[model samples]
Target: MNVNHSNITITESACKIADEICLPDTYLPRVVVIGGGFAGLALVEKLKHKEVQVVLIDKNNFHQFQPLFYQVATSALEPDSIVFPFRKQINGYKNVLFRLAEVEEIQPSTNTIITNKGNVHFDYLVLATGTTTNFFGMDSVESHSLGMKDIRDSLNIRHMMLQNLEQAAITCDDKERDALTNFVIVGGGPAGVEMAGALAEFCKYILPKDYPEYPSSIMNIYLIEAVGELLGAMSDKASSKTLKYLKDLKVKVLFNESVSDYDGSLVTTKSGKTILAKNLIWTAGVKGQFPKGIDEKHVVRGNRLKTNFFLMVEGYKNIFAIGDIAALISKDTPKGHPQVAQAAIQQGKWLGNSLLKIIKDKPVKPFEYKDKGSLATVGKRKAVADLGKFKFAGYFAWLLWSIVHLLSISGFRNRLMVGFNWAVSYFTYEKSNRLIIRNFKPKSLVNETEE
Candidate 1:
C-alpha cells in the first residue's frame, strides 16, 4: 500500500508491530503520559489514531485552564467554566485510557512509573507532570500564603476574600477589622496583577452594594512585586499601561518590593515596612512537579528536568518530558521555555508527531518553538497584549485577549460559558461567580504550594 508523506504516517510495519501487542498473552509497548495538563492533553489528542497504546494520567480529574485561574480566585468566573474533564477530552480514542493517579516516582532505566495506585511499565514515557507553586523554601510563607493553581486553590481564595469581608463587618475591634479588610498579593505576574485589579474593583464598585454593613473604602488591596514593574515578560509599553490601570483602580502597587516574612496576619517587606493582612496570596514562583525517584541533581533551575533539544530527558533514550517539567538545554533557551500553556501544547503536538515518525523508522525532527507572543487581562475592559512586532494595550487588546482565550479553552461548553460570563460581566460590570455558597474557615484551608 502506497502512503503519502504529506500527512503524519504510521508505517504498516509499525502498525503490525503495535497490533501484535494487542494480541492475547503478549506484552504491549505502553506509552504512558503523566499529568493531564495542557501538554499531556495535546499529546494524547494528536495520537488519537496512532498505533501506540497510550495512558494519560493526572492527580486531578479535570484539566484546568490555568491562564484564567485568577478569574476563578477573584470570582469573575466559576470553577466549572475554566475546568474540563480529562476523560471527556480523550473520549472515543480506543488506543488511549485515562487514569487519575498521583505519580510516586519515575524509574527511567526500567521504563517504569510507580504511582499511588500501582506501578506502570512503559515503552515510551512522557513526563508532562507540570509544576507546583514555589515558596522559595520559606515555610512561614508557604504555610500562610494562598496560591491559584487549581480549582480548589481558586475557590479557597474566593472563600477567604468573602470571609474576610464578613469577618470585618462583625468585628468590633478597629485594628482587627482593619486587618481583616486588607489583602496582600505577592508577585507581579498576570495572576497578581489581575487579582489586585479584581479586588480593587470589588472594593471600589461591587463591595459597597453587596456588603452595605461595612465600609468598602476600608478594604485595601496591595500588589507587591520584587521586580521594578508588573508583567515583566511583556513589552515596556504594556507593562506601564497595566501599572497605570491598576493604580487608577486604587490598587496600591508596590514595585521593587519583596515579602521578607509573613506570620499569618502581617506581611513584612524587605524594606522593613509591615502590612497587616489576613489574606496573603502568593503568585511568586513555580518549580517542576517531578516525581519522587528522579535524582534531585537532574532537577536544574526552577526544578525542571534537563532535556535535550528534542525534549528527551538527559541520560534516558525512550523517556521524554514536555511543558513545565521539561527544561531544554539549548543556547537559545539556556534555562527553559516559559512555563506557559502555549509552550506545553506546542511541545505536546510536536512530540506526538515525532514519536509517530520514530515508530515508523523515520528521522525525528528536533522541536523548535514559534513564539506567538503573550497577553494578560487586568480587569474589566482592561488588558495588555504583546504580539512581537505588534504590541497594543487597552480595551481593544482586552477584547483580543478574551477572544483568544475563549477559543483556546478545551471544551465547547467551557468556551460558551466563559463567553457568556464575559458578555454579562462586561455589560453590567458585575461578576456572577460572587456568591459565597460555603463559609470559609481558616483551619479548613489547604496550602496550594504543597510539593
Candidate 2:
C-alpha cells in the first residue's frame, strides 16, 4: 500500500508508525497478525468483514498448503497448485492489509513490532508463526540434511533428488552410484512415511522410464525412527497396516534406531550399522518459531509459548498465540493440541471470533480441538486411516485419503489440477512433470559471494 507521508514516531524508543507499513488511523482496535499459515489464514477469514483493522505480515507473499508439499517434492503435483497468493485471498476486505516483511522483534513495552521495513503499532497482537525444522542441536544434520518446511525447502529436496539421479546414471564407481541412489529419511511420523512412499514410487516407476541406465534395484530407501514403531500417535492397527504397506514397497523400515551421525557421505546408526547416503531428508520434528521479546520462561516444551484456556499468551492479555506456537493446557488436553492443520484452523477461527466478542464485551468460550481423523498413504492403492476407533487400510483408504487432501487444498483450480494429476498417475503408473525448473547446487559449490 502506497502512503504519502514517511515514518511517524509513536514513542521514545525504536517503535514508530510507518505510514507505508501501518494502515490509516482508525478508531477501531488494530490487530496485527504475524505469519500466514493455516492458523493465520483461518483467523483472517473470520475477521474479514468485522470491525477491526487487520494487518498480516509474512516473509512470503503466499499461503502454502503444507500437507501436499511432499507431492511437489516427488514431482506428483506442481508448486503453484499448493500455493495461494495472499493479496487475492483478502482482496475484498478493505480493513485487512498484507505486508511482505520479516518481523525482527516484538517490543511489548510500546505495543509495536520492529520489522525489517519499519515499526508498526498494534492494540492487539497474534502470533501464528507456526513451526520450523528442529535439528535437535545436531549441527551436522542441520548443515548437511535437506528439509521440507516451505516451498523453497521442498524444491531444494526435489532438485537435489533429481540431480543425484542424473549423477548416478553416468557414474562408473558402484559405491558412488549406490551413495547417490541411497535415500535415508529420519523420523517415522507422517512426514517421514509420506516422503518414503513418494520416493519409493519415483524409484519404482519414474526412474526406469526416465533413466534406463540405472536399474531400480540399485536404488534403496530407508526409514529410521528412534521409537519402536511408526506413527506413534495413531492407533496400533493403523500404524501396523501402514508399516506393512511400506514394507511391501521394499522400503527398509528400521525401528528403535536413531542416526548417530552423518558426515555428508556416510550414515552411522546407533545400532552400529553404516549406510552410504548422499540424500538424508530430515522429517524428524518441528518446533514453534517466533520473533524476540517473548520471555524464555513462557516458552514451554516443543518450543511453544504457554497460553491460557482463552489462547492469551502467558503473563500478557493483549498478546495471543495460536496454532503450533501455542501450548494451551486443559484438564482434557494436559499438553497443547496436536500440531495439525485442523487444530490450527480451529484455534484461529475461535480466537478471531473471541477477539470480536472481547471488543463487544460479550461472552467468549474456551478453545477446544476435535480430531476429525488422520490418514497417510504408502503407495499405489495402499494407505491407512484412523477415525476414532475405526481403523482401515488399502484401496478404499487411499480413495478417502485423496478426497480429504483434494478438499484441504486452498484453491479450486489447485484441487482440480491435483485430482487430474492423481488420475493420470493412477492409470499409467507414471509422473507427468519431472522437469527441474531451476538447477540447484550445494552451498559448497556456490561461493559465499554469489549466495
Candidate 3:
C-alpha cells in the first residue's frame, strides 16, 4: 500500500487509539523525542522536513538557555531574552510538531509512552530528558535551597535575594539583617562560579546605588566547593585565574567544603563550619531524569541509561538516549560524555543524521564527541578560556565568552535583547529591571502552607 505520508493531515489521519494522543497518521517513521533541551532540539532541527514525523514533547513550551541562567538569577539578563518558544522554533518546519506534556512512564514492550495528558506510540524513541538537581538525600538542604537547573529556579533566586535584601532594610536585628544579606552558593562548577560572579557584580555595581542606606560591603557573597579547585574540568591556568578573579571581586571562596544542611537562614558545612545565609543556591550536582520502565541492568551510575557507541540504549532496538540522561560509557568516555550542551548537541545531530540509515539497516558511523574547549566568566571583563592547547584569561577571554554565548542563543530577538542589555551594562554597569513579579517562598514554607 503506497500511501502519501507527506500530505497526511490531522483530519484525514486522526489517531484512532482510545485516549491516545491525537497525531497525524503517517506511513513515515515517527520519532518521538522526550525533551526539548539542546539535544532534542538539535535532533528535531536535523529531522525537520525529512521523511519522518518528529514529535517533540517537553514539560515546558519554551527552550531555556541554561548557560545564562545565572545572568537571569542575578538580574543581568531578563528571562524572556534567554528563552524561546518551541512553536516559534518550529514555525516553518512542516514535519515537526510540539506537545506540552510531562511524561510519566515508558512502556517499551508496547512501544508507547504514557504522559499526564495521554499516551503516545512511537516507531523510534529518544530520551533527552536531561538531568535534575541531585540533593544526595539532603532533605533539609533541598527544602531550603534553590537549584540552578531551569528558568524558574533563577527567578526564585532573584526574588529571594531581592526580598531578603528588602527585609534586611526593614529589620532592626543585626543577626537577622546579616543572614538576609549574605548569600551562600554551593558548587565550584560553571553554574555556581558564574552565579557567584554575577552576584558579586551586583553587590559591587548595583547594591550601593539601589540601597544607599547600607554600605556596599553589607552584602557578603560566599562560594563553597567540595573540591580543592574551581572548574575541575578546565585547565589549571583557567582555574587559578578564575580564583584570582573571584578574589578580586571579594567573593569569599571556600574550598574543600561541602554543605551538610540548610535551615533557610543557616548553612552548616560537613567540616562543622556554619554560615549565616538566607539565600542558598545549589549547583553542586545533577542526576539523570527520565520516565521509568527501562531495565535496571541498562542503568549505570548517576541514574543514566547506558548506551552503545551508536547512542542506542542497550537491550532495545529502537530506543535511544542522549544528553545528560544518556551514559555512553566506553574506554574513552569512562563517565560518559560530559553533561554539557556541546556534547548533547553533537549527540543529537549525530543521531538525527544516522537514524534513517539505522532504520534501513545501512552502515552508520559510531558517535564521536569533539571537545570544543571550556569558557567561564567572572564578573565583567574577567574570564577564562581553554581552547585546545591554548589557555588564556582576562578581557579577551571575556569578550570571546560574550560572543560565543550571544551567537548561541536561539532566536534573533533574544540575541538582540541580550546583546543590547550587555552593551548598556558594559558602559553604565546597569542590569535589567529587577521586579518581583510574584512572591517566592522556600520549599519548606510552601509545604507548611499546604499543610
Q: Go through the candidates in order and give the C-alpha RMSD of each one to the true structure.
A: 5.2, 4.0, 1.7
Per-residue lDDT for 251-281 in model 3, tens only? 9999999999999888999999999999999
Best by lDDT: 3
Better of 2 and 3 by TM-score: 3
* Model 3 lDDT on a 0 to 1 scale: 0.93
Error of 3 at 210 (Å): 0.5
Candidates sorted by lDDT, descending order? 3, 2, 1
lDDT of each: 0.83, 0.87, 0.93
Collision count of model 2: 0
Q: Residues 165-184, candidate 2, lDDT per residue (tens digit)?
A: 98998889999999999999
Cα deviation in Å at residue 308, candidate 3?
0.3
The positional error of residue 83 in candidate 2, measured at the CA in angstroms, is 0.3
Q: CA lDDT of 382 in candidate 3? A: 94
Deviation from truth (RMSD, Å), model 2:
4.0
